[model samples]
Target: MPTLHELPGLAGQRLGPTQWREMTQERVNAFADVTEDHNYIHVDPERAKASPFGRTIAHGYLGVALLAPISQQLLAVEDATGVNYGMDRLRFPAPLPVGERFRGTAEVAEVTEIKGGMQVKVTLEIEVDGQERPALVADCLFRYYA
Candidate 1:
């Protein structure tokens, strides 16, 4: 974690290609149950095997939702609390096939002072193991307050 005073200087710094995590079928199913998005492409391997992807894939939003935990591994401000502000932009460039390993990498794009806090824009990418393209890319904003 960086101190509040040091935060401003972190712009353009690259954070981790975090430890790899698998996108399991059970996790996909759980997300499907919670979001009520049981699209066969996400939850049904047999059916999805017939689709172009040739196997079940994770819902795009599931990767979006994973950003929270993934970001934790990349950033935190010392002696301050942070909250998600929003995303400036988001794109799923490639599907995250189920059972594949993925990890996050982040670059601190910009940091600015806010009225009672600081705001940072971090460009985050989730990459799938063995895939050339990333599963998701986002310019995510966050606010930190002491």
Candidate 2:
């Protein structure tokens, strides 16, 4: 948990390279099913091998969806009511092939006082283990009410 004053002071601070998580085929398939994004490269293992990636890859949006759970492993906000204000930008620089491990790190990009809360922009990166490029990069915003 972070104190009210602590959040403001955290601006420009770097958080963590969180525990790595595997991008399993099953998880990728489930995400594809739920989102109805049945792209062959993401859900069809055998067919994906013929694609440029040479293996089934996770959907770019799936990485975005996992940010909430992954961020929990990096930090917790137990003291305040936090609302997701949505993302500022998102990019997938590399493919996340199934069975690969990835982790996220966050830097507090900016913090501003709002009407009844504070809006914080966190520059987040989800990098695949052993890869130079990150699977996802996003500027996510959150509003925390004191």
Candidate 3:
């Protein structure tokens, strides 16, 4: 956990990469069940192969699902509770084909002290293996307080 003070200032910024496990069929199916985004490109493996992407693509929301886990590792937020305020700009430049690995990098774009809390905006870029473009990119805001 990261101390609250450690976060008041720009904690750190860099291009970080993670080698993810392959996006499995089971996982995609599970996400579909939970979100009700049963897009054929994400579940119909046989049919997906005939599409341009050549494989069932993972849901765009799955990329968002990784935010908390990755952010926890990236920021030290031990003493304070942070709220996921929301997103600003969001874009998915590439498809996340099933069985592919991807990772995210974040840059702290804005930080401010408001009331008794701190508001931070982090720009995130998610990329998949073998893809030159990013799968997801956005300005995600979070607020931490006493």
Among all candidates shown, the one with the greatest TM-score: 1
Q: What are the per-residue Cα lDDT tens digits for candidate 3 across 22-110?
A: 77889999999999988789999998888888889989888788776666556547778887889998888898888888777788887
Q: Model 2 over residues 1-146: C-alpha lDDT tens digits? A: 57655778888888898888899999998998899999999989999999999999999999998888766655566666777789989999999989999989999898898887688899889989999999999999988887
> What TM-score goes with each of the models?
0.98, 0.95, 0.89
Model 3 steric clash pairs: 2-76, 2-77
Candidate 1: which stretches are off by over 4 Å? none
The prediction achieving the highest lDDT against the true structure is 1
lDDT of 1 by residue, 13-128 (tens): 99998999999999999999999999999999999999999999999999989999888888977788889999999999999999999999999999999988899999999999
Error of 3 at 23 (Å): 1.6
* Local distance difference test scores for all models: 0.94, 0.86, 0.79
Better candidate number, 1 or 2, judged by TM-score? 1
Error of 3 at 84 (Å): 0.4
Q: In model 3, where do residues sit more than 4 Å from their true spots?
A: none
Q: Candidate 1, residue 88: CA error in Å?
A: 0.9
RMSD of each: 0.7, 1.2, 1.9
Model 2 per-residue lDDT at 71: 66
